[model samples]
Target: MNKLIKKKIKMKKLFSLLWLLCVCLTMYAQATKLTVDCQNPGWLSNKITYGDQMTVKDLTVTGYINDTDIKFLCALIRDRALSGGRLNLENTHIVGSISILDDCMSNGWNCLNGDGHLASLYLPKSLKKISSAIGNISVDSLYFSPQKIHAVSSESFYGGDNKKYLKHLFLGENIDSIPKYSFIDCENLTSIHLGKKMHYIGEAAFYASTNLKHLNWNEFTSSLDYIGPKAFLNTQWKPDTILIGDKIENFDVSSFKYKDGCHVFLGKKVQQISNASQWWSSGIQNIFLHSKSIVPPHISIRYDELHYFTAYIPHGSLNAYKSDDHWGKMNLIEDITHVDSIRIFPTNIVLGHLGETASLSAKVYPEDASIKEVEWMSTKNDVCIITSKGTITATGYGECSVIAKSKDGGLQAICRVAVKESRPLTAITLDIHSLQLEKGEQRQLKAILTPENPDDSNVIWSRSNDNIEVSNTGIVKAKNEGKVWVYAKSTDGAIGDSCKVEVITHVKGLHIEPASLTFKKLGDSFKLRAVLDPANATDTTITWSCATTDVCNVLEDGTVTAVGEGLAVILAYSNDGHYPSTCIVKVDTSTDINIQTIDYPKETQIYNIEGKQLTKLQKGVNIVRIRKGQVRKVIIR
Candidate 1:
């Protein structure tokens, strides 16, 4: 009997425990969800009252809880204000995690409660997520203590237009991953100070926010395993710097896509840059590679789809990026030979660089006998160090021509000399002055004659300080108040030719003008005018006259008039015995036809061949009318 009782007691205890568990589950299920219409004005006053603290009885959404509920919820939260009082949601329970779509952040739905609100909330530690589309809000700061949260999609706390009041951000310490497109276009995200506990960042996490300038991240989590496309598509990194964590291993092209040639810094261990050509040609105008090892000969560079391109070893990469032997080809002379008839001085022996030094004597004959003088000139005529007898000395290396004959006619030979040094300016002469120069104007100096052997002529040149610069062309610029000596000096220091510059300052006077003027087939008249010499002129009286008056007439004083169609010359003269001038005048004839008609009373009736009516008149002039064709108007006298 005692053993049976013990067995029954144990069974009873097990059933009791099961019954209690079932009761708790039933109560949880019975707690119904309560929601308040945030879009309706009465909901806030009736359902939510300031300081009316209450724990969530059941799963309660105090506002219009829908996919678009976050915006309204955010608005209601910010509307409650308390000075020196914090909005605390510590005891409140959010039954399920909130997940917001990405568009809410950018579509004005997220720009709710645009004023800084000091709010505190205690989410269920089991809460693993929150709406990523929590559009830009003006919350001063948030305190998130959820333990199970792992990811927050991009734009989670996006401060679209209300980003101004979102100066501070408090990321949940438990959160490790930030989804792509999170915080994108959040212009007011000035700084992102993350807790050291966070790890991964999804793609385009902070892509295109124009004003977000600061980001603080954990250094140990640099190796972000996965980043979605364009994670930071429209956002900027910390204006000052970006710190990467250790966990990052691979990044898609978009990771650095928006950056303008900014190289991703992969610490020291990376060797032999792979696929770096993209970094080179991808808008990177220049690059600095710091290395001490010589570039291997077989190393190849790749860009776009091509491979094996010689890296554009920059010009300044000598010591920075080392390379092996720079190869080059040997230089060789293309052509060499001696041209015939080179001039030389009788006492001079042209020593050529025959590999070594050797006297190579050359004999030349003037191809043209008309040459009065023959002399050898260096390749650079300046080294014309030829003796009076026509012998040349190679004081320098260069090619030269052996000139024969006089200025009238001459023959020549070209001899090329590989000159090493040059001699002084040799004999120079200016052609004797034959033309006159205007007063007050400077005369250009020209070197009329060059030294036959300029190499020997140590000619140093200069213009008489009075005024002149000896141009290389031997043309002199007059510097003196008046024309001065334009000259040339020889290498032996001798002046050869000279010229006189006449400065004419006088102006001559002459005058001419038309006495009559006429237009063809138009009115005829005379225009009296005169001409004066531009060289020398003064106020002088001029008289105009016509040769005859039959077709044109001229006044005794100076006017002329056209009498009929014809050409005439109007003569003009100065009161003194000054030069006389004449002008031609053309007169036009009337463009009218002449018609003759005679009428006999009984002979004919109508008009004449020219459509003019015939008329009879007495001996005394009688008034008669001539009709102008096609009109009633008639001409009569």
Candidate 2:
């Protein structure tokens, strides 16, 4: 009986051990296949391991899901799981906040451990809103439909402790604004494609995102109105070009700050820069202005900012900007006017009768070009004469070609001019009523004839006095100091007009001011003014002569330019016989020293030649007042 009882006890112990082993195997299998399907009601409430800590290979919540299902899944992944291989919520009506960070923090999970083995996350297309703070999570990529999402709240992708694992972020269409600090410190985020409806970017939205490189600004919507201050501050991604959208209205200070050189192309309607100081601090080196953009007067930049910045304006707007109070202060404003082609209006024209005229006009390429000056020429002078002002006059019954050439670039447009017939000449009129010229001065005069006839409208020019001579083409030349009357008569001798011409004598004496000048460096120029004895003398022509061309050169207008460090004498002689004036120029060579390195004694005092105490060495010739009253000249290039 004792042996049988012992056998029963051994059997009972073995049965108990087998039962415990079966339970352990079942729990292990459950951990590996952690998945929840909310297709059926009360599916989450029916699960026994809903919020228990377990190692999960995959956690998927799919089919007919709601906010409660999403929150429960996030809680499971946040509190219960040791390692989540994947978390997918597909084809579910997920609405409301999905705060994974909050769930992890509330459950006392090791959020800083960065061991959440979540490699991928996919929110269902039915997700209508995401008003949660999903930051500091390690995920390789994130994709969600932004169709119903309005904005990315602050700290949405803030990588708090773990290094951001997000490589690409696809925010689908319909996202509007990105709140402040949304992606702050997301160091590993490389690329992001903004939604088509994204309009406003809040302050510091992308601050300290050092590794984020590329953002497709072209995908930005037309309704984008403002970019808040410091929106892109301290970003590592240096875009090559920043193209502002046409509908953008304002750019706040440091909105698109960058570290590398970039070119900014302003939109056509971007009329205001809220604070130009922000642009001054940005790394943009070139700016291309729109044709109609009006640079605001409130924009102010420092000298250092202008040193590396260049503004390119329309071809003809250079002078207009140069004359502006604010824009004129910019040193490197250039014209980018380029002509690709030209079109002449009225490709073919016909003048019905002699004395009948028609005006020709051309449309130049890049219509905003500043220089629209066209040179008009007639191919066949016997048929018609085209004035420089683009007026075609029928001379006789014939055909001719009129060409309009651009003065800026030599692009030409041609027009076929045909003279059908000629009418009787009634009156001849000169373009200029009267003319006054000094001796040796010459000018071309224009004449027009009226009252049509089939005859040549070319006029015959004559001068009444020998002092002034008129050419056959109506060019007047002043031969002597006297008054004369120049006449332009029609070929038929029916009617004519006269122009009074006056000539003045040459200057008798010339005096050059500042007889001597000194230059401290090469490439310096000084202007020499000539004073005539008679203040009203007409002949102010003077010749400039340099004693040594190797040392210095004098221009025709009496501008002495120093070529090297040497002494030179510049002579100014009056063309009308007067005592010549001399100017001695001495260019100092000591100022041309090239400084390789500087070594100064400790506590040495330095100053400039103007006796101002120097705290630091300046560019160019720096007169150093050294220790013990000893002076030295140092040139810093």
What's the true lDDT of residue 451 in model 2?
Answer: 62
> TM-score of every model?
0.28, 0.44
What CA root-mean-square deviation does each model show from the true structure? 29.5, 39.1
- Among these predictions, the greatest TM-score belongs to 2
Instruction: After the best TM-score superposition of candidate 2, give how far the Cα of residue 391 lies from its true spot, in angstroms.
Output: 8.9
- Model 2, span 152-220: residue lDDT tens: 642333334443666667776767878877777777778777877887888778877778787887668
- Per-residue CA lDDT of model 1 for 348-452, tens digit only, reads 234443222322233444432222344444445443344445445555555455443323333444444344443445345554564344434545555544535
**Model 2, total clashes:** 8
Q: Model 1 off-target regions past 4 Å?
A: 1-80, 83-92, 95-126, 132-137, 154-167, 218-223, 226-246, 251-264, 268-637
